[model samples]
Target chain A: MTGALIAGIAAGLLAAVLHFAFVQSYILLGEQYETGELVHFQTPADHATEDHAAADQHDHGSHEHGDEPSVLQRNALTVGFTVLLYVAYGMLLTAGFAIASQFGRKITATEGALWGLAGFVAFQMAPGMGLAPELPGSAAADLTARQIWWWSTVVATGGGLALLAYGRSILTVVAGIVLLALPHVIGAPLLDAYYGYAPTEVGAIFSSRVLGVGLAVWVVLGWLAGRQWDRGAAA
Target chain B: MTTTTQTKTQSLLAPILGMAVIGLTVLLAVGHAQSATLHDAAHDMRHATGFPCH
Candidate 1:
């Protein structure tokens, strides 16, 4: 159990750090293209309209903002915090699997992959499409059409996770159906205001697709992890 | 002697078959979840993540 817990934390941290770095690099790519002043920082609220207007005011187009290769600042604060998040996510994943393992029924490489896929579908992709907050400044944030699609994905992800966890049993299957139905009856806002849902067919569609792809990635990761576990067992 | 050998084989076969059957069911269920509707932008994002969305 201890080993599993440790592995889970380690894996979560690893993934979180990688994701944070990826996002940081993505942001820097945009920042490098600026011809005028550098946007060091801004609050989310001000970022939406004010910053965008300010950027437009300065006629500094793409060329002015030279295409600079981004550097991953090797600062203790940035790296430390990013890695910590990754570790936490890893711990969650590893711990989940660890608990599952205790059943002794065990999952195969394929099954583990499926489980991983299930996680991605439910967590990142689904939430992002709907229940998760969007980049406040983005066009998608304002588009009611897009918002609806996003929320649907959130509902889908949650239902999907429940199904993955308890799919084997008939009772579990029934529970999944009930869970899925809840969004319709309860109406969107699955959590609170921060997690408000938009009821839109298009948003639902978007959520499902995004989440599905995420799940596929998880499947691959899970497969790799399972194979490693198998090797360890064999040894 | 042959019967004993056959029994051993059956014992191994049972667990494998059970696992395979369960695995198949799971795959199908997951497939259904994947096939649900999706947005073009979100779909593209999924691809960016190197996932085969279809």
Candidate 2:
């Protein structure tokens, strides 16, 4: 547990840095559109002509706007919160390792990374298939409904993956597959129509970048947790 | 020594599961269930981490 905490804190710091470098600018840009500080194409036809428009907007949004002060200020808290989030994720990973160890399976750093990948699949990739990383002004389904669906997806995916990883029996494997498929089959809550203040491209880039950051963070987290936990066990 | 090690392993499971529960509660609170004020404060992070957000 101590090892996981240490690793989680380290990974959290890394996550904060990665996010600041890659993801935050787009968030700021998306917010501008959300607040009407920036505007996108007025009609569907306008959207067809300028695919690069969102990228151009983001470039200026990052530089000329002189957003450095606020970005720095927000990131101070972001650093702390991000660290805490990873620490919690560490606990979950540690729990997974503990369960595996009880079954006489030893966790190596490589295996830890695989566990981290499983975490990514369960929490971000799977749910992301339906909801995605949304922008500020993006229209979403009811918050509560989204939350419910999100939780069910995480639990189902996590449990399913666990069963797949540890199950010795074909029946358990089938059950795991069923659990994995259940959430996607039920579907994520969705708005009846497409809507948002930002151009679709901005939102698209924002989401893909978010997922990318998530994968990096989770893998690092798992590796660190595994290394530390293995050290602890050996001692 | 074997008995002692088995006992240690058994005892560890409860605390590990307990920690997981707490960790999950915190994840949900900050990620999904926080109030509007907290949301405003944590806005950039909320999105950066891929929590469902407004």
Candidate 3:
């Protein structure tokens, strides 16, 4: 357990570093697009007044509005919060690995990588099928509703995958598949029409890049957690 | 034997409880965080993990 905790912290730190280096820029870019500084596309009802205000701010080269944090402050908060979030994620991953190891599976780097991929699929890809990643200015459904759907999807997919992987009986496998499909069948809430400030291409790139980075982080996390756990068990 | 069983139960329960507490804290912290800070901190993650945010 101590080893797992240590590994989780290490992985979280590493993932935080990687996120700061690679993921931050894209998100900033998306924000820019969101605020209309780099408009690639616009709808007929696009808020010209808002765009003009943003343009004025851009021309003044000042973002120091009241309650607006400075770049330094923003980046600092980003780092702190990201580290906190990833540490929690890592701990959960480690705990999960510990539980799985109790079932007699060998915990190794390779298995860890697989587990990481499974995490990515369960948490990201499966939910993404219904609720694709959104940019800052995009339209979305009610927040509470989306959150409920997202959590349910994550839980069902994770549980389903575990059953499929470990269940010995056909009944279990079927149940797993049912759980996996349950979320999509219920469906994520959607807007009556597609509406977003950013271009489709930008949203596409953002989504793909986000997932790509996530995959990398999870893989590293799993590898380290598995290695540390194994070493601790041996000791 | 009873002591051993108690130890085993505690060992199992500790990590699970720890995880639940940590997870809930993180979720609440992010859920109610300041918009911009939350966006920057979790923007990539929210997208990467398929949590909808507009």
Candidates in order have lDDT scores of 0.41, 0.83, 0.69
Give the Cα error of residue B23 in candidate 2, in Å: 1.2
True-vs-predicted CA distance for residue B39, candidate 3, Å: 6.1
Off by over 4 Å in 2: A42-70, B1-6
Pairs clashing within candidate 3: none
Model with the higher TM-score, candidate 2 or 3: 2
Q: Which candidate's TM-score is highest? A: 2
Best model number under DockQ: 2
Considering lDDT, which of the candidate structures 1 and 2 is the better prediction for this target? Answer: 2
Worst 10 residues of 3 chain B by lDDT: B41-50
Stronger candidate by DockQ (1 vs 3) = 3
Model 1 vs truth, CA RMSD: 14.0
Task: For residue A155, give model 3's deviation from the true position in Å.
Answer: 0.4
What's the TM for model 3?
Answer: 0.80
Which stretches in model 1 have alpha-carbon errors above 4 Å? A1-83, A136-169, A181-217, B1-54
Candidate that beats the other on TM-score, 1 or 2, i.e. the better one: 2
Interface RMSD of each: 13.2, 1.3, 2.9
Per-candidate alpha-carbon RMSD to the true structure:
14.0, 3.3, 5.1
